[model samples]
Target: MFRSLLIANRGEIACRIIRTARQLGIRTIAVYSDADANARFVRLADEAWRLGPAPARDSYLRAELILDIARQSGAEAIHPGYGFLSENAEFAQACADAGVVFVGPPPSAIAAMGSKSAAKQLMERAQVPLVPGYHGDEQDADFLHRQADQIDYPVLIKASAGGGGKGMRIVERSADFPDALASCRREASASFGDDRVLIERYLQKPRHIEIQVFADSQGHTVYLFERDCSVQRRHQKVLEEAPAPGMSAERRRDMGEAACAAARAVGYVGAGTVEFIAEPDGRFYFMEMNTRLQVEHPVTEMITGQDLVAWQLRVAAGEPLPLSQEALGIHGHAIEARIYAEDPDRDFLPATGQLVYLRPPAESDSVRVDTGVQQGDAITPYYDPMIAKLIVWGQDRAQALARLDSALADYRVLGVTTNIAFLRRLAAHPSFAQADLDTGLIARHHAELLPPASAQPALPALLAAACWQLTGEARHTAHPGWRLNAEWQRTLHLGYHGHPLAVRVTHHADGRWTLTLPDNSQHVLSAERHASQLTVHLAGQRLHADCLQHNDALHIYLPEGLSVFTLPNPYAAEADAQHGDTHLKAPMPGRVVALLAPLGEPVEKGAPLMILEAMKMEHTLVAPGPGHVAAFYFAVGEQVSEGSDLLDFVLP
Candidate 1:
């Protein structure tokens, strides 16, 4: 066992690696950028170093700086957690050259599987089942289009040099092939500095199942079962679970054997995932192999009772495999939900801001939270917006899902918008609960999955009113006799998210207050006053609202967000309503990757007009019209602020 190791990554994965390393009596060193100076992972490590400024290129992605830190800290090994430099072959070789072990696959395996095109060729040569596609070396535009034609329509164009749904696009027809290919190449070049892309026949109703395999320096490799990651949006996984819901014993063995074969072909070691795209009819095709630890490794850990990180450490220390293929056992079911700093209601736009309050559900006997952030930490736009991975284990899939739903509801994160509410809805979705999932699940149930703004609950205004009215009258005043002692002294009017809410408060002799909502329902509330905040309780819900009194208006804090309220006024009229508005604005702060719609071009209601790249994926801004484009407010490559105009058009 190694005495000390350095984690060449940041955020939750870094924190996760440190936890296991410490448990094995290994001291851990953490590297951080300027933006993450006070991050949770930094505090968790036994030693820490500043890599560089906030930009990833200057910090987390700098292989030279990371290698230097590991050498200076006298660390025996460097663990490159997923993302950033984890799959970078050059970084792995650099660590080896510097006499430091990289706790992952050998550099030779990474080089072979690092490029999608190269991996496809290798897999085909090794007799592994591969998806039928064009893996040719020719990058000519016409030649690629010819290959797409040969493969027929509905082909997937993916960046050969990158993963993570970054440089990937699906074209449904030959008419859209040319443009989609150009866009994919441009993004691939910008993201990975490689403009090469490959075309493949798109599989319909595909379930993403991956096998977790581990090997040791002694050339012993074994498969540890599989995980189903079929729940996705924009080709990115949202939820994952181990021991696929209905996988037969035969199918499991076949897939596991194939995965192990692929690993042996590349001389793979440590923890890695071999992903496959399985059709509805049970036929599975190799997608690609992740050369490092995955974000959802916890699910595999729960089912197999294995510490994958610990395995990596042992393997890196030149140890032989402790167990064989027949020795591994999997029990029960486990599921993981990726909680991100995004707004599902707003087309799943990435949100950036300070985290006011992040209260993840406390871990219980079966519940776990792997997080890289703390309360008051800022979510910047420089990297992935994933906040944490919420994982749960149970005796079966049903129990795991039930626990996940409950955990999601109990989670409370404020300051910036998140997908907590959205995840809660997804777990309860009928299709999802039934395990009938695919890449198009989010699109098929688009209306139900992403409800309009009107679907959001209107409780903020009511809560604001309750808080405003309850705190308006001070218990003590400048004049001693200003206090009033009636059954009920004040009726307060509060607003929540611009909605009016009327609340009446009755203070009892015991100091607890009773509040009546606009609907005439009454509930008891407890108050705990502080210098900056006022705590209130109703039913089983407790809220800590910050008090800000300005211009006779009081603001109340609700779980959804904060809202302001004013004094009761019967004469204040409501504004006129217009519901059929169109011409979408920027959902959040992002850069325009391209302008798909030309000036004065007529478009359908759901036509793609432009693409906004934010947080990591490409979001196609659609036209909610059957009218001609009135104007284009921004051009390609332009950075726009949140709510900045992208297009202006009148609906037909």
Candidate 2:
């Protein structure tokens, strides 16, 4: 095993690699940008070095700087963890040229699989089944459109050099093919610096399953079963599981062998994943091969009882395969949910803010959380907004589903929106629990998975907040002299989701208190507070909640979900309400990539106006109604902060 290793990445994957390296007695070195100077991964490494500014192009993507750091730190090997430079063939070759081992597939293997077009060609020669589509070099718009028409409508436009759902689009009809193709190409160029694309016949009701393959320098390769990544949004996975819910032994063996064949064709060494799109009848087609460790590898680990990172290290050191394919067996079912700092209600737009309060479910033999962030850390816009990956294991798929739902409820996050509630709903959805999953499962059951947002807070949450406030006040202030037979009264004003509410609390001379809701409903309750936990008794029923107070905002955690209430600031509320639709503001801090509508041109409602790129995704701003953009506040390619006005609009 190598004595010293440097991780050429950041975030949870970096932290994850460091944990395994330390277990094998390898001194781990971490590289960070300015934004991650105080990040959790940096604090966990044996030695740390700075790369550059927060932007990836200046920091994590700088292969020269990283190679210098590896040489200066005396690292024997560099582990590129799944993103940034992980799949960059040049970077891998550069590491080899610098006399440092690259703990991934050989540069040749990476180059072969780097482009979808080339990979499909290679897979075709290797006799691997492929999805029928166009994977050629012709880039003319008209030519691509003709190809799509021939393949029928509903073709998938994918960037030949992209992964993680960026630079991907699904066109449902020939009428929309031109615009979709143009938008897809632009996004592909911006994301991967490659405008070349491939067209695939979009499979309806397809389940995404990927086989995890490992290879050693001695030419021994084996498959580690498979993971079902069917639940997705924006073409990115949200939930993944191992030993796919309904996979038969015969099918598993066939897919595993196919994955291994692809690995052997490229002389693949170290860890890699071959993704496939499987039909309902068990027919699967090769999608693409990821040439590095995957983000959801923990699910495979939980079921197989193997440390994949350690495997990577040993293989890079020229060791033989740890175990043969016959010896590997799936032990139990495991499921992983990716908790991201995003709003499910808003098309899953990424969110950026400080983690004022974060409490994950306690980890044990059955439940695990892999994260590179902690309380008080910031989820910046410079990197992926993933908070953590929560993995749970059980004896069967049913038990795993139950445990997943429970763990999601126990999670608590504030200061920024999260997808915790949405995850819980997804796990509990009838279609998911029954194992009837597909790429369009979320779209099929959108109403149940994503319900309409409530305009008012729940009664129980409001009561809990009021009781928590009263208990806090009682601890700090001296009690007012009570009248012989009169009750003391106090009114509190709170806001929930922009709606102002006022609750009246009447404290009786006795022990009980009365709380009147905005609807004039009354509840007589007794409450007790212990730190962040609050228990309330009302009308012979007992309710418990967790309250986290940050500044004037109170985060109330209930069994159903989380509710955030704040003490209303009259001045700020008025200002926010008055800022109407006269200007279009950026929802998040990002660079303006395109201006869709010309200035002073009247556009219909919902017409695309501008595109702002943030967190590796593009969000298009639209006209609220029939209006013309009067002026552009920020030009294309300029960065704008959250809530900054991007343009001024005048209603026609």
Candidate 3:
């Protein structure tokens, strides 16, 4: 084992690597940017060093700077944790030149699989099954269009050097191909600095399954079963599981062998994954290869009882394989759900804010949480918006599903929007519970998975918020509801989801209270508060909840879901109603990428006006109605803050 190790990444994966290194008695060194100066991972490491500014290009991707840090810290090895510089072949080769061990595949292997087009050709020679498409180097738009026309409609345009669902598009009709191709190329150039792309037949209703393969310097390779990553949104995985729901023994062996063969073909070493697109009839085709640890590797670890990071370290130390192919076996089923700070109802737009309050489910032998953020950390626009990964294990798939649903219900977050409620609904959906999954599962069941936000707060939420406020006031005042001759009455005005709500509370002499809504409906209720936890008795039922207050906003956490309410301001509401439609503001902090509509020209409703790039994704601003853009406040290639006015629109 190495005496000292340096982690070349940040966030959860960096924290994850530190834990394993500590167990192995290795001194772990962490590198961070200005944005992560006080991050959890920095505090967990034995020593930490600052790289540069918050942007990745200024810090994490600075190969020479990282190598210099490794030399100064006396690190014997460097672990590239999954993103940023994980798959950069030049960085790997630079570490070698600096005389530091790189805990990943050799640079030759990474270079061979760097480009999607070239990798497909290599797999062809290796006799691996491949999807039919154009993998040539023809970059002409007309040439690609002709190729797509020959392959038929409904083809996939994927960036030659892309991963993580970026720089990819699906054209469903002949008329949409040109626009889709242009958008795909733009994203590719922005993300990878390479605009080359290839087109392939888009497989409808296909399940995504990938095999985890490991190799050592002694030419020994083995497979660690497979994970089904079929439930996805926007071509990115949302939920994953091990020992695919209905995989047969014969098919599993065949796919495992094929994955190992692919690894051996490239002289691969350390941890890697070979993805495949499988049909319902048991036929599968090669998709692509990831030359580093996967984000969803926890599910595989739970089923196989192995620490993959430890394996990567041992392999990099020139050790033999831990176990032969015949020695490994699946123990139980495990499922993992990625928790992100985003709004699912608004097309999964990334959100940014301080994590005012955070609570996760209890961890046990069966439940686990992998995260690098604490309660006070902020989810900024400089990087990915992932909060954590929740993993659960059970004796079978049914038990795993039950645990997943229960765990998702117990999660609580505030100050920014989250998709916890949506995940709970997705886990309990009838189709999902029945194991009927595909890449388009979320799109097919969109109505059920993502219901609109409630127009008004639920009665329990309102009552809880009101009681919490009253009890807090009582702590400061001696007799808040004491009256000489009559019961004391108070009214609370709150806003939820843009709707105003007024609740009237009357405290009676018998130590009970009657609460009335705007519609005159009344309910008898009483509550006892201890810190932030509230125990209430309402209408012959007892309920337990958590209420957090920040400034004038109240967050209610219940068994059903989360509700956010703010103190109503009538003047601000009226002003917003008058100007909100005419003033176009940036939904989140990002850089202006393009201007689609011409200024002072009339455009129809739903016309795309501008494109903003944030959190590694593109968001298109559209016309709210038939109008013209009178002026633009920001130019292309300029950064804009959240809620900043970007343009002014005039009604036709």
User: TM-score of every model?
Assistant: 0.85, 0.96, 0.97
- Backbone collision count in every prediction? 5, 0, 0
TM-score of 3: 0.97
Best-to-worst lDDT order = 2, 3, 1
Any runs in candidate 3 off by more than 4 Å, and if so which? 471-482, 578-580
lDDT of prediction 2: 0.90
Q: Which ten residues in a row have the lowest lDDT in candidate 2?
A: 471-480
lDDT of 3 by residue, 1-652 (tens): 9999999999999999999999999999999999999999999999999999999889988989999999999999999998788888999999998899999999999988888998999999888988889988989999999999999979999999898888999998878888888888888887777889999999989999999999999999999999999999988899999989999999999999999998999999999999999998999998899999999999999999999999999999999989999999999999999999999988899999999888899999899999989999999999989999999999999999989988888887877888888899999899889999889999999998988777765565455555555555322223454588689877776678777777777878877788787778787787877777877788788888887777667777787777777776557878788776788999999999889889999999999999999976888999999999999999999999999999998886
Q: Give the higher-TM-score candidate: 1 or 3.
A: 3
Backbone clashes in model 1, listed as residue pairs: 460-496, 461-495, 461-496, 465-494, 495-565
The residue-by-residue lDDT of candidate 1 on 1-652, one tens digit each, is 9999999899999999999999999999999999999999999999899999987778988899889888899999999999888988999999999999999999999988888889999999988888889987899989999999999979999999878788899999999888888888877876777889989999988999999999898889899899999988877899999989889999999999999999999999888899999999999999899999999999999998888888889999999776788888888999999999997866778899888767788897689999999988989887889899999999988999999987886676666778887887788889999988787887888888766444223354444544444455432222212345645445555444446555566667666667677677777766665644676676787876565454445544444433445554343443112323654678877789888777787888888888887765677878776876678888878887777867876777
Q: Between the candidate structures 2 and 3, which one is better when assessed by TM-score?
A: 3
Weakest 10 consecutive residues, lDDT, candidate 3? 473-482
**Predicted candidate 2 versus true structure: per-residue lDDT over 1-652, tens digit per residue:** 8999999999999999999998999999999999999999999999999999999989999999999999999999999999799998999999999999999999999999999999999999988999999998898999999999999978999999999999999999999998888888878886777878999999989999999999998989999999999999989999999989899999999999999999999999999999999999889999999999999999999999999999999999998989999889999899999999998888888999999888999999999999999999999999999999999999999999989988999998877899999999999988999999899999888888888757656564456546555555322234445677888876676777777667777888777888888878788888877778888888898888887777777777888887777676658857766756667788899998888898887899999999999987889988889989889988889999998978888886
Alpha-carbon runs more than 4 Å astray in model 2: 455-459, 471-484
- Evaluated at residue 116, the lDDT of candidate 3 is 91
lDDT of 1: 0.82
